[model samples]
Target: MTEGLPMAVPAQGLPPRVRIHEVGARDGLQNEKAVVPTEVKAEFIHRLAHAGLTTIEATSFVRPEWVPQLADAERLFPMLADLGGAPDIELPVLVPNGRGLDRAIALGARRIAVFGSATESFAKANLNRTVDESLAMFEPVVARARDDRMWVRGYLSMCFGDPWEGPVPIHQVVRVAKALRDMGCDELSLGDTIGVATPGHVQTLLAELNEEGVPTDVLAVHFHDTYGQALANTLAALQHGVTTVDASAGGLGGCPYAKSATGNLATEDLVWMLDGLGIETGVDLGRLVATSGWLAERLGRPSPSRTVRALSHKE
Candidate 1:
């Protein structure tokens, strides 16, 4: 395929623009089997910002032993301190607990995310705590973040399905999402960690969240493409008025704790769809593809993004 833009065809009732929460530096890299060098990771984030991804998730403040790939969070965050212009780019970091929150706050992190789970299995596997226990742990963290006047994002994983458990109920997801929103999260990224969600499931969950007083304005959708449903699920969320969508640069990352999970929705692919639909993301497609290509080269693997494959000639 040629290195070109997609045809513009506007979609009805969709938002004029979408805020892509780029997660390649954090979520994508953390799942890597090998530890990526800190210098290289910093360069990747810089490239992502240069590619016009305004809100890039810089790194996770989780314990080093828990996610070895992102062990250089302290060293990496400073490298991106000057990654912007007119509208300074937003760099959000993930914090697993109060200790993690302390680490981030010390680094002058203005935005932080607290990760939770919709199911007991994922909560136990990822956080080593029960669902209620994890929420209790996050309460203090979220409260502290809010007190500091920082933007807090709540990531509720396994919203659609859990590998250990089967299909997840919508009400169960809503219960957890409501709890997170009620706990003072500025935004909530509903995660389909195992990628078992369909469009119908996505819409149903969003509706349930709305009914439970979790408005669509503060909602984001994070979908994995394990069963080729991420894009479809994202479109469903868009139709339901969700504007913030989380995606990895090149379909990079899966749940480190869930074996059945696959890569996230590719930023390039998402941009391609939004571009074709005449929706604005402010991302330069060619530049974004090249950035993913550069990261793919450093990792010694081709990008999983179809748009990247079609637009970039790998060496």
Candidate 2:
């Protein structure tokens, strides 16, 4: 947690803290057609930190061929390593495999995330492997990360729907999530990659997971705004006691594979909704909006955050 920020304990006694993982640097910049300059990426990260976002996904360690935009991770992470007068924040990079992990570790990454999709077809298409094969690949990587004493987060993409296989089976999602949890992931982020999840779908899955005794503490929600349901789905997850939700600054991301999807839930929008519900996020709304505006300008487009738009208009 970022220190010195005042805690917001809800008057109604809601859990006083929720983890908001900022993925704008990696996930947000990954899908961009135009290469975001290394200096620009660095400044974006600095603004995010000043906005009180404690956990920011700094970059990805994948091969340049896979994601050319983040090819600069090697350099970007090193520059950010010296930020905030001692790197007080948690900066996690996405590592696709052992090679990616090696690059991330070389860049002094203390934390990393691995990607996996729940549906077999989706996994094969996105990761070029079956669901089981994907898990198998992560086993060694997770072991190595644990040996290094680094925090590992598992990303389960297409948790709700898939382009090739629509409406993923509940059992399939549960099986994969349980496998990742058993593999020693500190957190499992269930992604609505295509943004097809509803509040009911979220509740149903959580209910089933609860019955199976999967700890909700290790769960996080990652939602896209395809059908404009990301915020609604996030609210449902919050009701189920899921305290961690992934959001991108300015909604600056989308699936390069999943068509018609917008991006991760906008951080400003998510924070605004949480604040209205009297939930605690430890994020300054004005600073967050400013950061979003700055990034939106960098991207040369308008921010997709409705809350940001409304607040800025009022001001």
Candidate 3:
């Protein structure tokens, strides 16, 4: 088990350790217009693991036509098979359905994730099905994955607000989350797909979920920085007993289905804040910054992480 800092009571009752689920390799690069080379993707994941990120989301098994950038998932998984030898490290692939799950299982993947949407508009636009239909699609996938003893995660997008549907109600978000949880997902990540969530909104949604008997132990938060509220909302979730957060390296991802959405919270930025609070994440800040800087060259732009920019003198 990863040891955290000595427990210090904060006024907000936050946990001493926070698990930063690194999503840069998959989520961050998925929306990029240019295709990143498969070898580069492998190197990036290796660097992230070296930076002390234990749970790195490596690639998605979606159809190439949908996400051409990650079309090399099959090629990339084999390159990462060596890293899985470390008991502390996990490389999870995003599997859209049973076919995607089959591709991952054939490559020896032990962890996989399924995605759903909270709002009807996003559900239809992204998955080409209604919210219930998407959940139905995930049921068999999650069941088969668990039967194989592979860890399964379910993601609920647009939990706070939606672009086409306007403000999403707390009840609606809870309903989808409950269904995902009941489907045998080991964890459920609530996403601010368009990044319109505020601290108050996060608190309200979490509180309601808690009332509905969804324990925080099985929950994670995935926030986007579109409105500059990602960190603040994360702090709110932490205070509410959420210990897992999903962040991208260098603040690299945006939802392609939501044009108005911006990048996801940067792992470097999240680490900086958690370090300041004396919360342990077992990640090396300096090395994480360097990794982002290295990726920036391939991306042809400076990293969006303020911590990386500040430390690199790019400010």
The parts of candidate 2 lying over 4 Å away from their true place are 1-14, 84-88
For candidate 2, lDDT tens digit of each residue in 143-198?
Answer: 99999999999999988898888889998899999898889899999999989999
- lDDT against the true structure, each candidate: 0.91, 0.86, 0.93
Q: Which stretches of candidate 1 lie over 4 Å from their true place?
A: 1-3, 84-86, 313-315
Ranking by TM-score: 1, 3, 2
| Least accurate 10 contiguous residues by lDDT in model 2 | 1-10
Give the C-alpha miss distance for residue 121 in model 3, angstroms. 0.6
* Candidate 1 residue pairs in clash (backbone atoms < 3 Å): none
Best candidate according to TM-score: 1
lDDT of 3 at 82: 81
* 196-227: candidate 3 lDDT, tens digit per residue: 99999999999999899899899999999998
Any residue pairs clashing in model 3, and if so which? none
In model 1, the worst 10-residue window by lDDT is 79-88
Candidate 1 lDDT, tens digit per residue, 33-55? 99999999989988888898899
The deviation in Å at residue 24 for candidate 2 is 1.0
| Residue 284 lDDT (model 1) | 96
